[model samples]
Target chain A: MSPSPEQAAFPEAFAAALREPRSAIPARLAARPGVDPAVRFAIYRNNMAAGLGRVLADRFPVLRRLLGADFFAALTDAFIRQHPPAGPVLLEYGALFPNFVERFPPSQHLAYLADVARLEWLRHCALLAADAAPIDRAALAAQPPDVMARLRFTLHPSLAILRSPFPIVSIWRANIDPANPAVVPAGLPGENALLVRPGLVAEIHAVPASRADFVERLQAGVALGDATNLVGADLTAALAFLLSAGILTGFFPVSDDAARRSDPA
Target chain B: MAPRRIPSLSTSAVPASRPTPAGLSPPAGVGLRPPHFRAALAEPGAVDFLEVHPENYLCDGGPQHHFLTALRQDLPLSFHGVGLSLGGADRPDRRHLARLRQLVDRYQPFHFSEHLAWSSHGGTYFNDLLPLPYTQANLARMSAHVAETQDCLGRQILIENPSLYLTFAESEMSEAEFLAELSRRSGCRLLLDINNLYVSAINAGWDSWAMLAEFPQDAVAQIHLAGHDHCRDADGGSLLIDTHGMPVADPVWDLFAAIAPRLAGVPVLIEWDQDLPDWPRLVSEASLARQLAGNALAEARHVAIA
Candidate 1:
């Protein structure tokens, strides 16, 4: 009763059949009697394409709202067929969809669609990312000033830094939450933002070029002294600002010996 | 001077006891969706029970958990799992089952259910229920997996029939026969989805009623009714797609009315997964089933009165 080698290979055949249209199915499959295998097979193809499309839409609601339903549906179908689900979870299905839309021939005119999708994706990631307790203010206050220079900060799992050529945050906020006013300029050069889950809510923090660079350095686990030099060499002001905003969650206590070995400078 | 204060939740709250019931039959219930949580809680009504997917409640403490907790207090619960992968040829993923069991222990749902389709193969998770070849080998594998799941949870589970689009030439037995045999071998019950039966019947050119008639009557514990999309095949032939949006079609309701009397008051749920409507619309759909159930009860009472 074990499935033969041919039977085990059905999923591969199924995946192939899904990418091609009904007209593309082999004549031999259609010639089968009674059940009409071609007819049966087409239903699955549609389901596979439509199901993936729905998952992508769920991941990027603002993109769908902005692009209109019909356009997003077409783009989603194309992306899903070209790139089938790499994981069993639909939550993990559309990791590359935003990038796909960016380069897709038909969608090239809508350059900002991809950035809107990225914003939605960052929100999704923030929602499902692992939970961690924010750094206690008392712990930071307790650390001696001498050891503070070597503290390597750990960013929360939900933190994501993105810079886009369009004012994507305004675009996303305007479509999804209309309480915020629409982007008056409609088109603008690159804006930077941080996506983070502080409580249960996912918040978009609009940071300046300076803060973004500082966060990038700390995220790379660069020691405070070196990271300060990399960003602007004004550690005191930056540290005070980040701590006040609750942006720096926790810091790894790197001893003087370990710090010296890691950073010979 | 004010006393020093420490921030803490109610860490000393004692865990509640969970009640487990025996046998197959389920009470009438509604599928709990996210949008309907407020309406469900605010209104006063008699929905015999409620069911939810354990995957949606995986977080430790969140809004979803809060809703599930509130609903669990009011009605009997059923933990229907969507990601268990019981029919996968590979070993049943223990982590998924353990998480489900943890929910079971916490909520102590009256019933637990999963489908008889493989969703994961070679580590690629399709997330959609793929058809299984109803051969003896698959039956044996699924039986063992079901037994393992039941043992892990320390309770018997009801396995639902899948909605199939294509039939494999390699399948050795009909789906009903295979499911009946699986129940016999694995000590599991059945969750009969009436809409799926109708959809599969139309697509595969089989008798929907005959399919249900063949299923083991004693093994069936619950029923599902949902809407489907009607489409055409490659050769312009008719096909019914099991898309769980929209209202329950007329034919599905007719089938439920016909088969319900025979099953002796099995719990039926109205499932709408996509394009979800407002609370009243979904509730009205459930209300239709409740009306049917009420009619069945009235007829039974008349027979007793006679």
Candidate 2:
């Protein structure tokens, strides 16, 4: 029942038609004579684009509500046309939508949209990341100094830290929850925050600038002491903050022989 | 290419304990969502199966996982995938396939199914079930794709017919003919959507009855009933859109009644994604399907007795 080898060329052409609205065989095929096929095919194209646009709008509801419906519609259309889906899993369709909004010309006025999108994307990533049991705090405390040195701490899979200039949390809260004490902090300042799923819910919290730099270094696998010094005297506070947040899961200590082999000093 | 071997079985993804599919009756079941998890669990045997979207549970642990676990304990479950993109021109997505296989192993679902449309191409995902033109090229491609999917998942997958918006002038065959061909070529079963048949038929100006007649009933394993929306074209002509928000229209129900007699006890599922009613209301909608199937069975019995 499969199509013969001779008929296998239709898929390429069909794929093209699905991509470009006006790129199919002559419109007259639907109804002959230099008649307008656009009017007939236009409905299909409109429905396809509009339906997909609405999907993006829904996925990025906070973004849409901020940008207003009409602007979001135009942006969604352009994004879909330029970047059609590569697979059927639409759960990830808008992975780059936030970046698209940031780079979009009309959206230059709304500066915080991209950061908010980044936060949403990270939230989605955190939600789907591999689940890990919370690290054994008691075990960490019991390890000797030398054994702990080799330990490479493993952060919870659901942890993501974001730094943004705009008061994105405020904006996101206002548009989504509304009644949560609206406080629009002074103009867009450099902001750092973490998104972690401790239980089942993804919680977002702002991290101080020093803690952001320290955690970034720790996440890079630097020695604990060296990573601590990265934040000066606040190293203890930063490490405690991250540990208490349940972001650090477990550590893999380096073997003594391997440590000795790498000891250049 | 030589038919690739199916993946080895894994039990990590399926429920710890599940009854094998044996002499299972096609009892009425409502599409399971988070909102009704409590009510669904409260009433034992209220429904026969709980169908969950596998994509929603791809996460390691979350509210979605919590509800599915709780519901899995009390009822038989089915894994319905919305993102396999099995009809795409390229090969099946390996990562998506592995994740799905893992979930199947964990859940040990009684049945598994996916849509007959492609949602992704080139790296971008559309999130909507986009239709394919029924051409020889597409049929061959889809058949291979379905085979590939079954090979990866290590089980037979039922492919549901899609509700299309437009027809391609270059189509070499009807949608029903294409599906029939794919089923034969891929060795996969069919999940016929009578509502989709009616909707697509109305949208593309095809004869609904003729299309249904052409459908490969022998391959059918399940049936889907859902509501659709109506839109007017420039000429004021009506277009029935497969929106899945409203209640089943009367004409679609009539079509189902007409076709039910021919099918050999296909499992029926009522899907209401958008404008969802209260749990009882949705249960009532599924009850109607059970009622109709019951009536058909009774009529058959009467014939035998007579």
Candidate 3:
């Protein structure tokens, strides 16, 4: 339908008032006796910022704790102005927050904040990920031993592997739980986090670097033999951990030719 | 005031064969917040029904889904949408409509509702319920969108009146007229939010009682009561923001007392979305509403006999 002349101007004007800080209320809006158009518009601005800010705080609680409430409010305001939600689902609104923090000028001093944000984002995603039944151990053990080597496994939908140069896991843990005694040490080695939702609750486990490598390769659809070969760590222990955690939901045997054909360039 | 006989409106366009599960009655209820989930589930009879914003539970599986599924089995559910911009220039987003359809099918709520304001525009969704002009073109757009949404969901939905901060110079009709016309053209019902009516009237310098008198009460299927915050504008004029952070104000409760008799048996909801009180306090608010509704029904009956 063709936009009416009035309809054409209303949204454009209202949107400008919302986006531009303290922009004069559009000519289309009327001021009541006591309510100035500008002040009324400010309420909307505050509401938009505060609503999105609350969603950000809920998704990135550690970020909020790391940056005190006032600073976090300012950061969320900036983020809101730059990247308002693209859709109605607030749960999925902060996908780009981690990248935004990475490029954020003021946050440059806190180099590890972006990685921590990424970890939090992963946990948020895992919490809302699709539901699936875990593979039964007996069903998998019944397969032939030779087939196990060529077997390709499907990871549960709520699984994410995050590798960061900073000790993001320790930072997240310490910040999320104040009672935890694990202090984030300076000059510490990086950490790998395995995020999974085996049941209703999502959990992040700090895994060894080798296990991260093995899981990453397995997640990429590599067969068990290839994934184990790629990791120099104890294959049996990693396999046991994966099986016990119920991270592997299903597996299918693959022929050598099929595996070679499916391999990415 | 004498009892007004509301005309029997045709609500049969939407199928009514799928009755709500046994034991669920459309009495007064409260918006189900996360904090009160366990309490609400534990005491299913605490409220007549429960209202929820579908946007909060769009995810596939989680504690939210688990709780809502368990609650729906016992309590009558009402899906109140805060995301669908029925008044936007664009037709309702197809993907959002599909998700809403999925929710409606799964829950089979007693009633479904969305605001008569726009939240998204030009591909950017503002979290707040933004106001719009009540012009002919905008009215046409809103009516068409409402009809499309109803057809998409294969059921009737209610369009609610929004609390306003500013009015448009281009608006040619009052909010009541706009809502009545929208319902007339779209075959949808109205969710008369008395708190919103009071807030908008006070903000826009209109008479709340007059607006209530002109409201299309017969077309109303539900009523919402919530609290607003008192603030000052730039010129030191009073501004009431629909914060929904406090208990229902006395003035709003008075308005409810005035209108409840006319809207007998309509499901009323007490919405305390922010700074939510404890579960017992919230349920107490619903009890107050039930008492007021009961008195209204009795008054209407007395007038009928007289």
Residues B1-306 of candidate 2 have per-residue lDDT tens digits of 122223244432221211223321246777887678778878846776678788777777756677787777777677788887787766788988999999888888867898888776666565667666677777888899899999999999899998866555667787778888888899888888889988878776778888888888888877889999987655666677787788888988887776766663566889988777888888888778766765665565567679
Model 3: how far residue A51 lies from native, Å: 0.8
Stretches of candidate 2 above 4 Å error?
A: A1-14, A21-40, A141-152, A178-188, A230-240, A252-265, B1-25, B33-46, B53-63, B83-95, B116-138, B168-175, B261-264
Whole-model lDDT, candidate 2?
0.72
Please estimate how well model 3 matches the true structure, expressed as its whole-model Cα lDDT: 0.84
Candidate structures ordered by TM-score, highest first: 3, 2, 1
Model 1 lDDT per residue over B130-204, tens place: 776788878888999999999999989999988877766667898989999999999999998988888878777
User: What level of docking quality does candidate 3 show?
Assistant: medium
Task: Give TM-scores of chain A for all candidates.
Answer: 0.79, 0.77, 0.89
lDDT of 3 by residue, B1-306 (tens): 443333242322121111233312226889999889899998988887788999988998877888999998777788899988999887899899999899888887878999989998888999989899998888998999999999998889999999998888889998999999999999999999999999999899899999999999989999999989998776777789999999899999888888887776678899999988999999889878877766665666677789
Please give the DockQ score of every candidate, comma-separated.
Answer: 0.28, 0.30, 0.66
lDDT, model 1, position A6? 39
Best by TM-score: 3
